[model samples]
Target chain A: MTRRWIRWLPAIAVPAVIAAGVLIVPLSANAAVDLPAKTPQQVLEMVATTSVDAFSGTVVQTADLGLPELPQIGQTAGSGSNAPGTDSGQTASIAAALEFLTGTHTARVFVDGPTKTRLQVMDSLAERDLVHNGSNVWLYDSAKNAATRVTLPQGDATVPNDGSTTIQTPAEMADRLLASVGPSTTVTVGDNTRVAGRPVYDLVLTPKSADTLVGSVSIGVDSETGLPLQVLVRARGQQSPAFRIAFSDVTLTAPSAGLFDFTPPAGATVTQQALPQSNSATGHATMPAAPPTVTGTGWDTVVSLPAGQGTSTMLDSPMLAQVTTSVSGGRLLSTSLLNVYLSQDGRVFAGAVPLSVLQSAATGR
Target chain B: MLGALAAIPVLIAIAVRVTSGSSSGRGPAFLDQITQNGLFVALTAMVVSTPLFLPLTVGVVAGDTISGEASHGTLRYLLAAPAGRVRLLVVKFVGAAVFCLSAAGSVVLAGILIGAILFPVGPVTLLSGDTVGPVESIGRLALVASYVAVSLLGLSAIGLFISTLTDVPVGAMAATVVLAVTAQVLGALPQLDWLHPWLFTNYWLGFADLLRQPIAWDSFGSNAVLQLGYIVVFGALAYSRFTTKDVLS
Candidate 1:
């Protein structure tokens, strides 16, 4: 009996060893990082003057915006429609937008120089790629077997502002947030942390006013490269971050030039598009009937859209009705950090504030 | 057994050939691509078989390892023939592992053969929407087969342990297959989200990562580690049970 028991020892001992290793490995990897301290101004300067570029990385974006989960109506419904004013088209667009704001998405980003960049959004059993090689830009969606090609005018360096390229990297998001820093924001240096296995300094930004739903925003700047590796935004009273975009893995070396060169494969529906003229040249033609207007400033800013931009049709969407509650003025779509109020008059007011604030804005009080 | 496994892709290729084309995104992943590039037949077959057929066959072969010998009253004779108990166990486990590899290999080989005959063979479009030449596509398919084979190692180890627990071969086979199905069912339940990463079946379909432009090896690495854990634990369990139990037959 003793011999039999001895033979069975490995079954218990092996699993115990594995369990302990799993617990200890992560703890050791997260051992407190130590880095030389820098003031907020120095870090801001570091971000503003950083010259490092031409890198490849895998980015992960996760959002827990406190929105109810909607049924996954496949990409077909949204991609098939071109008219944004029609009922199905509006509903499909809203559902697609909400879908983008809810789930965790992984994208591979490859950049070489200023003009050659590729973003590949990895989806389950499908993929979407936007490749910009100098003046040539190609957008390919595997699920739809569709490709769109755009040739930029000579000497134009900017990629076409198509809706397909909305998923931005941490660097892009951090640049936009840093541009808004002023007296209304309190910028401070937090503890040194590690992101994507590299030492980084955490620069924390907090809104001074309590009126804004945003509690704080933290940016992880790589110590060696001064590039923003991660951006985390927390909503007031929320323990976890409301939205996070970070590079899970990054390599500083430039990606191969072949990655930027894209050709629409056979059987794909390829559409050749001419780049839209610059906004300064044709600003009025591209503007909506009544362009959205902004009120307030800093984090409490509210964007109001007039009655004719399909706000009423969006409210009529069954998918939208499922998530929004009927408020006194109209329907209110509320998230952890953002609120949208659709007034009975078909005007829409949206802000990173409470529904009451959106209501007041909608009433033009 | 490999012939039976090989017939699956053959049947699929013929079916798709007869139908001329499958609507994209409607059926098994890569099913629509089979008509365009013959290489997709292998990928489609692997995806369809990974969930059920592969595991079922693996369970049968692995579960019959020791129990079938014991049930036939040959295990005691073999032991008395100077083949040490541990050596016999290791040999049996290795035999089952080889079956796992050949099973995946046969499906891929038959798929390519039948697909080449039935459809136009040319550049293959990866899941990332990038196209690769026929040679690279075949190489990717091989990697996918290897991934699927590695995925089954854990299940084979579990089946071997279950086989050691019983003298009835059929009972062991049934129990092993049932456990595989149970793991998959539990994995599908969102309520047990925390238990997902531990399940062996969690990454069975993750071979699609190999089809991406810049292959995502994260799933492959995680799946290997998870399977290695299962192998070590279950191999130890099978060792303890097989060595401790008396050969009464």
Candidate 2:
């Protein structure tokens, strides 16, 4: 009996060894690292002054806005509806935009300077690529079998912000968050950690006021390169991050030059466009009507759109009605970090504040 | 068995030819592309069969490895000969692994040949909207087959271990197939998110990464590592049981 049991020893030992290795490897990789200490101001100055560019990495964005899960009635209900009028059309477009904000998205980013860049959003069995090389920009969608070419004016190399490209890297998101680091925010260094296998300093920004929905923002600044590798936003009283964008893998080396060159494949519907001169400089021409007026400043700011901006038609849609609840004055769409109030009139109010604040702002207007 | 696997792509291609209608984005992922490019026929067939058909066939073959010989009253004679128990176990595993490879190969080969006969063949458009010549596309198809072959190896090991425990070949086959289905069911449950990564079926559809413009090797590498771990753990278990068990039949 003893000899027979010895024959089965390998079976028991092998699995135990593998389970131990699996548990230990990740713990060792995430072990605490000691880096050169730097104050919050010094880290902010490092991020502002660093000029390391021309790198390639893969970025993943995840959002958990605490929105109710909508049933899968059909793709037509969420996508472009065949209904003729602008009422269903605008509602369909808003529904489509909300789809991007709910799911996890993975995109490969390649930048070879300010002029040459490429972003490939990888979906399930499909891809959408935006290639910017010099004055030429190509947007290709494999599922639709369509390609669009936009020609920028001479000496203009920046990607046109047409609101279609909602995916952003950690660096771009950090820039937007850092702009709000004035008197209303308190900045401090939380911990020294590792991101994308590199040492990083966690710069935490906490809002001084309690009115804003945002609790705090944490940025992972690469210790050596000063590039922001990750940005995490947490809503008040939420344990998990409300929104997160981070580099899963990254390298500082410049990508291959051939990656920037894009020619529309045969059998694809191609459309040619030119970037408007005025829109190219400002980069915020998403709305056709006048820009919404701001009510307050800093985190408590509320944006109010005037009447006749098509807010009533969107609120009337059955799909939007499922997510929004009726408030005292209008329908209210509330999320963990943002709120929108659509009044009985065509006026609309939106902010990152609470629902009560948005309701008060609407009544005050 | 490979003949049946090859017939899948042929039937799919002929049906598309007869219907002569666009897929309208219904059915499997690449089913809609089959009308425009014949090469998509192979991809669609692979995607359709991966979840159930491939696993079922692999389970039958692997589950019959040891039990079939015992049920036929040939195990005692074979061991009575010069063949050692350890060498016989290794041979059975190698036989099952070969079947996994041929099963994937037949589907891909039939897809390419039928697609060429039915539609106009040209440069293949990848998932990234970039076009590659015929040579590179064939190379990519081969890699996809190998990735699928690797994906099934873990299930084969599980089936082989189960075969050593029973004298009835049918029971072994059914049990193996049940385990595969159970793993897939557990993988689909969102509440069991922590257990999803450990399932063997998690990366079965990851071969689509091979079709990208600059192929992503992350899934391929991860799948290979996970399968190798399964093989080591179960191969030892099978060895322990097969060597210690008596061949009274």
Candidate 3:
């Protein structure tokens, strides 16, 4: 019996070794040893100085804003009247924005220099491609088979100033988070790791303010390339991430020029428009736009938009009153990621923190 | 049986192309990626087969490994040939695992051949939206196929254990299949979610992470660990039971 058991050892040993080889080692084999180390400040400085001429990759974004069960944003757009307790267009836009922020989406992003960028958000069996080639920008919606082309005025037009298009990427979010890292944030360096097989270092920024719900944000920057790999945002009192966007794969080669060229598909509707030009030449700074004022610094930063621009009348709307609860001197609408304060004095305050932060900013606290 | 089973992926690929223009509800996670390149045919083949067809084929083959010989009265002859009971059991388990790989491999091979001819074969747009060359895509497909084959290790071991108990091959086969389905059913229950990580099928779909741009290793790594755990435990149980059991045949 002992001899029989000994014969069986080879079978067990071989498979055991094979299993261990395939299952165990490779999981942690991602990062190589003998990599250089850098402080968080150095990493950030390196990231800020590095410039990417052109590249393309896939990005996945997930947002968990502590939102309640919302109606499917896709089918709810024009069909809002079909559902009770749904305001037609106003609430739908907010719901759409919320839906856009929350769920996981796979987007194909191509950047050929800063001036030429293309982003295509993939949907089931369809896609939406946003192509900006110099002064000519095209937004192609395959679901609707509609393409909108906007021509920029000469060289100085920021034609794609629309909020939704610009803030969709992890790199863009990293820029915003890093820009906010001044006196209000405590920056530290994390351990070295790998992203897309490139050595990367994590720069962690923690907000010193206690009034906000934001805990900290960690940015993964490729050590050699200085490109941002991932961005993770965790709210206060939560161990898990509240929002994250990262590349599952990436290539740093310059994209082909033809990728930026856009032509509307056959039988697709096309709309053309011209954007207002930025006038440093005009000398008046154009329309005398009211600057966005921030009342608090760092994590508790509450940004208030100028009041009495038809926004005050929006506060009295029945739909707005139905969804929001009357706070101290304002109507408060809260979601997991953002809090909006509509003060009775016609001020609009928004932040990722809390309603109190927004209220304080409204009251100039 | 293997030949017939291998043809399923090719047939599914044809069916997918036939219904490409029509809505088939939500088919899989990366339908756009699949539609972009025919190479993903192998991925779609494996994805569709893992939950039911592949496991079913695995159960039948593994279930027959020992019981078929016993039912045919060849088990005693084989053992009398100086092949110890333990050695014979090990060989049977290894044979079953090879069949699992070949069965899935045949699907992949057929998918590549048929898919290359039918659909546009080019750089695959990964789930992460990064484009990988055809050769690299093939490598990823090989990885996916192998990972899938490895994922069935637990089921194969369990089936082998069931084979040792019964002399009827069909009964053992049916029992193994039922157990797989039962594990899946239990895994699906929200109340029994705690049992999901322990279930062999829990990480079957974890291969999706492999297609990410940077390749998320956590889920796929956990899958292998869990499957390895199942293999060790069930393999030991099979060894213990077969060693002291009476062989009337």
Candidate 4:
């Protein structure tokens, strides 16, 4: 009898495992555009085809970004790289920007003109999922279960690495170095190709700063695949080297509108960020901000308020440990390497963020 | 050296934290840290000492290499010795360069170690808009670091060059940093686009260029050559300047 049951165990377990997998499958299969598997063009196709409803994934791809290291050349420049996990924010933002630009992550980018308007929607470690839509931006920081919105400035070098709509993370600042790439910028083919099984071309951008830096960018593409493989930003003259972003595991599929869709929970708080006009969220909607309560705890302005409303909190104490910022908005309130936080309240939050990400987001803002 | 070493971690932590920006992402972490982040305070701390350290290291060496002799009134005696001005300058320049490298290296090593202790470093997981698997980050980061080291040769040379131009090592070190910063700020002008090609700092970015995917060897090589040229020119200039300058200390 035991032997018979044991044999039957395989049969029973097979169905059980299959059922278990079936349950597990749906967890990562959100209708969101977390498409780390799709190439840039494929992602564009996904944007073109997907309906306002279906599509999504939990995929993440990394490509080898070939950016030239900036040269410190003739200066006493180096931000100091001795801190360890301390730069986690900069690291995350840089990663996010790279992933978004290279299409290593799922994103919805809206460009109005060649150099005019742009917006990018993606996730951030600090603010959870965020949308850089025009001058108005929103974040759903699920961690703090809050939401925030910010009306940003344009034309200024507000964010790091972001020329128009994209932004750098806190750790992204770690990429700042003293390289000697001068003001002359050009695009050229690169040799360190073949990342994510794709071919790449090098796009070298010289620094606009008068600093003795050598800035270079290597944009890799998978030739046969015609997908962006990576983007590397280098500054050789800095005491510390620059940063790189690479893409791995790309797929092709149209993402449903649900990927960009966000709704505040019933009881979540919301912070509107004193901006004009709502996000015009085309899909399901979120909640509104709670009446102004004490904005935050005694410390931590970058905190989440009730009703998914978020306030930028940098709670430092004789009080906070570090200048740790907590963004509270929508369902996305969370800590970020950079001070900018995203929350679920249909808002974007940023206070003294990195210039790279600032540039990226600000352009959109 | 130890004080400088200590500053590296604090700076790294500040770099990591302040640059981490608002739960907001995408920008220079440093600016975020300084402008409106907690890391600013830490960075402030680093900046305070940074200015002092550069001079101290170079000063100690310069004083030992030059002033100490003067203080002992052995300037004439040393001049009387077989050491040519060029040889004396070479020895000091090389010594200062090595010190600069060592000082910078100390910070980097401390930073990585502190990173291991302070944060997760299983692999150097580079975060793009997407993410990298845990297994692959280390090798890539290692490559990144190597490139960084190569690129930093510019700064090292700058320090060396400055050291040779001045009998006062502290003055040399300070002057080097100032020149570096000035060049850095000036290198960004569209109007000065003409001047960029000749600037050595233009070549300092070669290491970062290597991080590009299908890394652009042509540009990278070009950048490397340009930087190498700058180093050689600067190095030679320092050599010549020091050899001919009369030691009046």
Candidate 5:
């Protein structure tokens, strides 16, 4: 018996070694190590005080919004002068834009102070980059070989206002979650974790209101640098996260100045268009016009615009028809990250909460 | 195999160039934007061909290697010639491997010709948003072609073994294609993700890693090793089965 077993050992050993070679993938390079814990308030204070800005990293944004099927973006006209108010076209563009926002996308991000930032979203062989350097902003889509340059209003960069549609980074997202830390929420220290190979402390915030569908929002703040490495959001009753944005790899050193510089690649189709000028006397460049109004605030906030506002040409698109279904009083497109309700009453309501939350807002407001 | 090597590349080159030239309106989402680059066209041709066309050709060639001789009553005569079963199987495997490499090489050659004529050849932009010089891009294309060809070794071995079991070439060929498609289908299912790494076709698309700036060796290395594993195990199985079998045909 011993001799027979020895004969088979070589075969078994070879396969076992090969299997190990294929299966062993480390989850994170930063192994779990002992780190000091801090209170939730201390974590929030650290986030507010963190000065490690002007860094570059690769971020992956994933939205699980419980979507039935991810919408496929078909042939889009290769021009940024696209009309924004047309019905079906707008809907198609919105749907296509939303598609880019949902999937697990890898983006290279660079932040050089508050006014200068650059993000390049990589899609297969194509790239879409957004660079905001002071007042001059450029959005370039290499897939279309098209570039759109817009100059923001002179003082728009200094204004402390909301409703602007500038691309949101992980730090801004952490700030948004932290700013909502008020009387309607309870904060606590959750776990000592590692993010992007850096030791971090998680601060968990739970909404006090039962009317809100948000279960909890946790921000992982780097212990030493105080920069938020990740922000995760989960809706009520869901086990997995609905939306997550995290740096897979990050560095605190300031990125180079040329990284934010933009010169369209040779042969790219350039469309020079100034943003809608504010009503000021000079009538110079202004911030892109803000989208429709939002009713209510905090976790239950509902952003509603006219039904045909940005649905553009996609209103009657068969592609749109395929991904969304009509519900009781509206057409509901649900993904793991957020739900959008387009009602027959000629209004589109969208929120991070559930359809029920949107419905309540639709009825109440 | 020679016929495939001669005919398939020209056919694929013409087809890819024509489709790329005319599909300006609403063709594939990305290829239209990159129509100006020949290297991209060649890369596109390889990607378009790998899933079905190349595999079909490989299946037929591998499937016919042994069974075609048996169906013609040549197996016994060949066995009588003192070229033992193990040696005979090895020769057949070498022939099938040569076919796989040359067939893939033919497509790459055709793509290069068409791309050079129909589009501009210059520094190529990789999927990672970094650009590599023309020489490096060609090297990456060669790497991609090699990876694709090597990835099919497991399929070749499987088809050769199946061919040994049957005297009808068509039946063996059909079995090989069906099994290849089945592995692909299983790999596509999200619920069966755990089974993917073990599947023969799982790492077939790992050639895309060559298009990355730094060249992601993680997937590329695993894929090469996995296919090697498949070749060794299946090659041994074929040797064991053929050596003990009776020459009844």
Candidate 6:
């Protein structure tokens, strides 16, 4: 009986492990995940090296509205909304929620109809980018000339901001969106369509992760130049409130440097409090080592951080286009409309991977 | 026109809940559920509108019932005979209550029929907390219709109180409708919540609350108890005032 049972255990064990893996850990932290990395400089060079035609179009947005009984000023609670600790609706679209994840940004989104347009802005929002710069995970505030670290409410979690992270540059957003999905993401080609004067490839990004926030995403690219012309996001949970960023007025040539500088409207408060900085400040850094591979998967990189050791940004479905990337312990995760940021102390004196390789090398140990 | 007029608001409330507000969602409080519950809807419309309008109809009958007889000198001839003054007053009060109750009764019966035909029944949706399913809508509507009955006590009390004051029933009936409306208007103000505990209109407001999701039992329970108190006090006032008043005329 023992010998027969032992023989049967192997078959059951594999399926059991697979089920356990899908449930216990979040999809963002797959140990055997790998992405191809390209640096900001490298990303810029890729853009500089390519030639594309400029297409002028308009962006449109449709929003659904609902009204609920509201608590009066200073009234902490009201009759209709009595669920303690749970907000009646989602808060993914609040300006404070996504203010930090992005640097200076821009994007051009095409609405469904031909005649309408919408302007999506990504200027240096004061006090918004303090945390990212202070934490040194990303950009410095152009106005403050100070490293910005996004400040989070003591115990609250954040969603990734789609506009700043995804639309910083046309190429960066496209590449990041392409990289965020994994091998499990299914790909398909759509009906031939033309935007501007160029034909484009239509790519849909479905999360390979078992639990993905994105229900569906479609990107229209300039087939001639490989540049993305438009992107659309469909998410879950944001029934009453939805997020949409359609960029119009595409200017490839710099808009006279003054367009990026942001000055606060007069009388707006500028409260500055220096953030605590340390070498291990991100709390997501680890001693650098060579990227490793999983035992069975064919991917080149393996990020095998133990459970509860990483911070990640995600766009939870209800608030489609709303994104969050967080880092805890030795793992960092960031999400933008275009790119997913994952990094550790990839800058080691010996056998360390490059910072840009973090997302691609995740499949490697 | 009167029947259709009173039926309209109740029906509108029911249709609104069915059309948009959580279709199968968290049900309204016992008060709010009335909006969806067919029987309560009918009862509410009948109770409220009849008090304001039907009394005038009753007054026309009453005004003629007494003064027409008095104009013919039947009261003087009858007073000279064995019939006592108290019996006449008693009969008048009873007849008026019966008439008012019967009119208001249509609100209840109509509410039931309308609720059965229009609302999805059986599982009751609670206003604040949920204990609802499709099957409860019927049973829940039936339960809430009782509150409308409680609301009608004021109508009868006012009618009876005024009926004792005069032989001309028309004047008494018109005066009663005006008093009821004044009370209701006073009760409707937002600032009245502090005084709602004291107002008889509090019971009328109770029926409206039944339409809210997750039936609020606390409000319903309190309204029911307070409503009984109003009936007892108001009934006693009408009885005492009628019993002691001059009847020689």
Better of 1 and 6 by lDDT: 1
Error of 1 at A118 (Å): 0.7
Q: Candidate 1, overall lDDT?
A: 0.85
Model 4 misses residue B235 by how many Å?
A: 3.1
Better of 1 and 4 by TM-score: 1
Q: How much does candidate 6 score in TM-score? A: 0.33
Best by TM-score: 1
RMSD each, Å? 3.0, 3.2, 8.1, 24.3, 6.0, 26.5
In model 4, state the lDDT of residue B82.
90
Candidate that would win on DockQ: 1
Chain B TM-score, model 4, reads 0.64
Measured against the true chain A, the candidates' chain A TM-scores are 0.92, 0.89, 0.79, 0.35, 0.80, 0.34
Question: On residues A1-365, what C-alpha lDDT tens digit does candidate 5 reach at each position?
Answer: 56545544544565676667655645343446577767777888899999976888878887766654242233244222344444444443445555645546667788888888777665544466777788887777665566667778887864221111223567889988787778878899776788788888888888777766678888888999889989898887778798888997887888878766676655466776645532221121121234577876666677876545325334456666777788988788776546788777667788766788888777876
Query: Residue B181: error of model 6 in Å?
Result: 1.5
In model 1, state the lDDT of residue A262: 84
Find the candidate with the highest lDDT and give its number: 1
In Å, residue A1's CA in model 4 sits off its true spot by 99
**For model 1, what is the alpha-carbon lDDT of residue A191?**
83
Off by over 4 Å in 2: A68-92, A155-165, A274-288, B21-24, B244-247
lDDT of 3 by residue, A1-365 (tens): 88667645654775577667766766765545446777777898888987876788878876666554344334323322323233344444344445565555667788878788888765433456688898898876544445778787677535463323333566777887887678988999877776656677888888887777778888889787788888988888776688888886787898778778776643356877555532221211211257767766767767787776446656766655765788899788776556888888777888877776676566663
lDDT of 1 by residue, A230-311 (tens): 9999999999899999999999999988888787888888978766643322222323467789998998999998786456
Off by over 4 Å in 6: A1-365, B1-105, B115-124, B129-136, B190-194, B208-249
TM-score of predicted structure 2: 0.91
True contacts kept of 3: 0.00
At residue B151, candidate 1 shows an lDDT of: 97
Native contacts, share recovered per candidate: 0.58, 0.51, 0.00, 0.00, 0.04, 0.00
Interface RMSD of each: 2.5, 3.0, 8.6, 27.7, 5.6, 31.1
For residue A344, model 1's alpha carbon misses the true position, in angstroms, by 2.7
Task: Provide the lowest-lDDT 10-residue window in model 4 chain A.
Answer: A73-82
**Candidate 5 local Cα displacement, residue A82, angstroms:** 8.4
